[model samples]
Target: MLVHVRSDGVNAKYNEELATECLVWINQVTGGSVNTAGDMDNFYEVLKDGTLLCQLVNSIQSGIVKKVNNSKMAFKCMENINAFLEAARQLGVPAQETFQTVDLWERQNLNSVVICLQSLGRKAGNYGKPSIGPKEAEKNERVFSEEKLKAGQTIIGLQMGSNKGANQSGINFGNTRHM
Candidate 1:
């Protein structure tokens, strides 16, 4: 969860806070037996040779073994699930459908929650990588133009659409009959 964002100009400490919040939420939802400090060590141990889903299933099974069934735990689980989804959203991870499906307090829904967390984790891992910034894009464009020039080709940029067509400005096509 130690993400360096130098290339993207993101606040690494803030991202760490978000990651910690996500971990705490997962810990609470899983009754403190998954995604905790110790649990993550075990997770990494399994992750070296196994897939994410396998790691998730193993972690969830261990958590279930240690879970205490109670109304308070149930309530906290749901609250933490919501908080986790919110944190993931704030971190630019998409989990809307997964959240909607796994928000319930059914045991069968645990797999969906695991899947969502896996997806968020994967996206978070990639979040720190460099992107095509404006400067980089301009450089690429210049290089492409140079390549085209070297190949004796002229880049002809064309705009194919016009506003004078049947779909006029401010016209509502839905209001017309299809006769």
Candidate 2:
């Protein structure tokens, strides 16, 4: 049977820890522009405008975000976020690892913002930049030979009822009835 589990939201404690870690990393990448040494508590508010995010992505890989909007106007700020995300994408950060503009702008899911930053950090090493958080995931794409593919097609998988000649010939289901 399938069951549905309700999720309230992200872990506040984990978000706090990750936000701190990302702040320190952003400071390191931005060369103290983020100020983790003193303003550690206001991680979200500090980055809510998306300027730091643009700076962070540019640090990871140069020339990605051509221009970061310094304006505090909401749409302009969201444009900064979009630029950062696009730069992260160019840096090979998967889209799934990034958050939407609303997630960061409206603070709907700060954890996702942290996650996206961590992803960008992980990808930093690819561009010979300083990195933080978990190491970036490696791509291990497998290629099969045509002969191997043909051989696989000829074989019946065990889950497909081969099971050493076992069969369900005698099985019976309940008779149809309106009870």
lDDT (tens digit, per residue) of candidate 1 on 1-179:
34222333222112333334445544543344444332323333322221222222224333312332223454555554454455556544564535442323332233334445545554443444221212211233434576667675453335645445575567675667768
For candidate 2, the TM-score is 0.68
In candidate 2, how many Å is residue 69 off? 1.1
CA shift of 57, model 2, Å: 1.3
**Poorest lDDT segment (10 consecutive residues) of candidate 1:** 129-138
Each candidate's lDDT (Cα)? 0.39, 0.77
Off by over 4 Å in 1: 1-76, 101-104, 126-143, 146-179
Clashes of 1: 0
Q: Which candidate is the best by lDDT?
A: 2
